[model samples]
Target chain A: MSIMRLLLVEDNARLASLIREGLDRQGFAVDWCESVAGAEHALKINAYDLMLLDLGLPDGEGLDLVRKLRRAKLMLPILILTARGGLDDRVLGLDAGADDYLIKPFQIPELAARCRALLRRPGASLGTTLIVGNISLDTAERTVMVGGHTIEATPREVSLLERLLRRAGHVVAKPALEGALYSMDAEVTPNALEACMSRLRKRLNAAAADVQIRTVHGVGYALFAPVSTDG
Target chain B: MDKAGNRKTGPTGPTLFRQIALRLSGFTLLFAAMDVAIVVVTYSSQPESLAQELLSLEAERVQSATDTDPDYLAGPPGADRWSARYIDDLGEIAGASVGSANGGRLMDWTRRERIAGGYRITGVRSVVRHGKQHWLLMQFEGDGIRPYAPVILDEIVQHVAVPLIPLSTLLLIFNIVAVRRVLKPLRQAEAEVDALDPDNGFHRLSEVTEPREVNTLVRAVNRALMRLDEAMAMLRSFTANAAHELRTPLSIMQLSLDRLPPGEVRDELQADTQHMTRLVEQMLDLAQADALAPELLEQVDLADIGREVVAAMAPKAFADHRDLQFACHGNTIVLGHAEAITRIYRNLIDNALKHAPGQTAIDVIAGPGPQLSVRDHGAGIADEDLPRLFDRFWRKDRRKTDGAGLGLGIVQKLAQVHGGTAMVENAADGGAVFRVTFLAAEPAKPA
Candidate 1:
């Protein structure tokens, strides 16, 4: 499998560097640009799996590029990363052809989870069933199995497991995971998504799943193959 | 500006131009009607006098004729166009000419009698002709001598028509121009009031050109504006203070935590900062949405906004094994701020997604009430919880911490600011439905 490459278009140098380092540690290569013009130049010379676009740029509004790219019929998934977290701004970003929206002061894990979700789209050259170590999820069937033994999971748990397995070994954002585990129409209590995740984790461990889901403090959840310390 | 003094309904009844025009027209019509009545009265009161004049002329003509010839039964030929009659006191037809009236043969002499060419004038007189009593009734073409008042009136009208018609017209035009000029300052005051912009800052209405009465109104309006300006300034400061005091530390902590190595400790710190940041941002948004003025409202398509929000959140819904659908039958337009309306959709959709059962489809529908309603398929909300659902920081389960519990409160506030209402109710089968209704926009006019 080839490693996914991403383009980050943001004006803030510090935030750009932090996001770049974080994604680099997540087994992806990220190319950073600080302006719309620079980002355009990078896109012309190289291919990227996704582009994290910031709305406010030095030269112009970032949405202009989104409009231009959509006009050109370029099928690249553009995720909007901006300090503008207003509801209208989110709608505008999505209407302007952005695939995802993340407000400023966002967590690296959430950003990573969004990138994973976008990469796992059908045309992104990724498989349907997500696998990490011995655990696998068939997104089509909403099923989860470990060590070739099908584990009993509610549909909600399977959906949650699907999200964690897709971004295996990397922190999956809590909000993103919650979004994945329940319908927005559900009357979920506060942190109820977390409660559901805890139950799913226990079920996976009870089934002796080789992969273990780890909570990354306030960040999110990560699934990784446990180290064999018996040697 | 004493409220009791301004309660005079007469002052507000009509414009000066209208009042003057109406009075002048009414006065002109009254004079014209009086002139007509005078002519009618004068002509009607003089019929007896006209008959007496004709009788004396006939007597003179007959007496002279008898002296020339005592048996004269008619006046001399061509003496006058009027034909005279001679009758004895016993009321017998004494003599008659080819067309002369026979007075003794008349049935009623008190009233004017019709003759061949014109009317017959009858008069009773004992004329001593040959020492005998005789009555003379004159029949003539009295059409030649009409009533005197009509002739006088005709003369009067001819003399006055040229000048009076133009004079009244000039009076009417002058009244219009003078009234308009007098009211110009009041109109100027009205225009100034219309142009005042509260958003631009404090602008006192101009009292310079306004009449004293209008100046009072200007002062009252300016006073109200001052109160609004003060309130706006306070709100501005509150937002500024909140921004400076809360966001700075949150930003600093988030940036500092960014440098921490990848671990559970750093992750927890980051999540806490994220939560705090969300709360601060939402608080500010709620304040802004609540304080939006009516003038800031805009025309927007509710369905298009719904579709965009649902499309934006569809991935999250899909990941949760739930379906998000937007159903709109027709144009759902409303007058509202785009930001406030968008927040309404975002918060409602978030609530529905979080509260409903897993794998349930959530539908965002543009309803016939010109409202946007988000319907879920999970169990409906409890009757007790419905009332407090929109209260700040109120939650059915306090232990759940996905949100600061301000989302619904902000939704209600935003709806209220747009002159709309937010309502929640249970669907027929199950699940909770959240609805926000707005003022429908005027339909698009044809070009």
Candidate 2:
């Protein structure tokens, strides 16, 4: 499999290097730029899977770049890394066509999970029913079964499993799952997303599913299907 | 002279309208009194002049009668030259002299001449007597003092007194209307100033109409407002710049800390970073809340916000072995922005969880005014601490809690933005209740 590539536009040298190191450890080839001008040059030359942008750039604002790329009709997924407060930058960046936003001082694992979630949206040709070892999920039927026996699940659980099954091997950020489960207008309870994931993990385990939900501490969750040993 | 003095000494003691009315009434009364005094003085001195005029007319009549009657003035019948006599202008003696024989010893009084002592000169000319012109002259000498004050008073009452009442009444009515017109702008300015909210410090006094007096006052007030607006803007910008600069480095520190390996040392560092992050975030929130304009608010459902916050904090409550529940009495609609109201609820719940000990249950109650109160079953707030609970960076036990002491301050500010207030008190059942009340919006119409 080809290595997944990411472009990071950040001005802060220490923060940019740390994030690059962290994503590189997660098996991503990240190209870093310090300004919007440099980012534009990199984008013109390279075909990247996704772009992680910083809003406060030395040469120009990250939002301006997002707008420029979107205006050019580029379909690349862009996630904003902003130090701005929630009231302003978050709303404006999303309105400007950013796929997601992570506030600064965020965990490295969380950023990795978000990148994985963004990458999973494309190139998944597994059809409506996802099979990860013995665990099978039918998106159309909104049902989950292990070894051909159905396990009872709430609607919320069914939707969560569908999201997890799509990115079966990759970790999904808590906020990404939260966004999937609730509409923008819905008020999500604190730790509500974690509680839902916990319940789903218990249900999948009780049903003797082959896959297990593994939690990435200070990050999110991932569905791991153990390698088969019965050769 | 001192109306626009220092604010404490200004005419705020009474309503502007009343002050203007009193001044107008005072001027009117002074003018009216002067008018009355002028009339009385002029009328009072008229009696003496009237007596002199009568004496002059008698002298003129006597001179004209003597000229007409050549024999009567020579010595009428048995009259001597020194005897008091009356002569008609037709050369005939008309009647006995009104003076006593002793009057002859007095000085002769002539027409237009002054009578020295106790005597009065009297004369009458026949304006049309018996179809013949006749003038009579006589002199009286016993007691010249006769009461003419009554006659003068009768003249004054007949002419001047009749119109004085209605004229003064009209003057008074005109004074009142004129005073009100002159003070109309001042009244309006007063009302406008009363309604001016320091929260929206940019507003200025409206322009006053012509008549340079009112314009001067209005201009001064507007100038003061402009200065106040500039000062407030400077302060606000300073706060905004300081907050932004401070948050940048804090964000970098937090991001760097996130890259460390998971361990006790890392955990401790992360906790400190979280504490710093919260302080920065709260400072921003507090500033934003303080700067929020009242007109920008909208209808918000406190119950809905409360329920969501309780649900969101449910996991934390569970982690701490506590129960968090929400109860609503009725429709809790308040006039405020939903985001701000939501933050208020989040802060209250967080404050409760931090302060309440022993895994106590936190109950959130929502009621009318769309009021929301968070009750925590912990040691109640100290009596001395209640007043300062909403003060910025004030904590009862700063070392015991992880809060930056800005959460309640933000809550208080948000409540004020909504045209409401925030209060905290110890509950009777050994806990503390933090309540926020907002202005009630219009009732929702039925679908």
What's the lDDT for residue A193 in model 1? 78
DockQ, every prediction? 0.08, 0.16
Query: How would you encode candidate 1's per-residue C-alpha lDDT over B264-295 as one tens digit per residue?
Result: 99999878887788787777777666556678
Candidate 2 residue lDDT tens string, A7-68: 99988787788888878988999999999999999999999989999888888889989999
TM-score of chain A of 2: 0.63
For every candidate structure, what is the RMSD over all alpha carbons to the true structure, in angstroms?
15.2, 10.3
Overall lDDT per candidate, in order of appearance: 0.72, 0.72
By summed lDDT, the worst window of 10 consecutive residues in model 2 chain A runs over A222-231
Whole-model lDDT, model 2: 0.72
Best by DockQ: 2
Scored by lDDT, model 1 comes in at 0.72
Superposition-based RMSD of candidate 2 using all C-alpha atoms, in angstroms: 10.3
What lDDT score goes with residue B347 in model 2?
Answer: 94
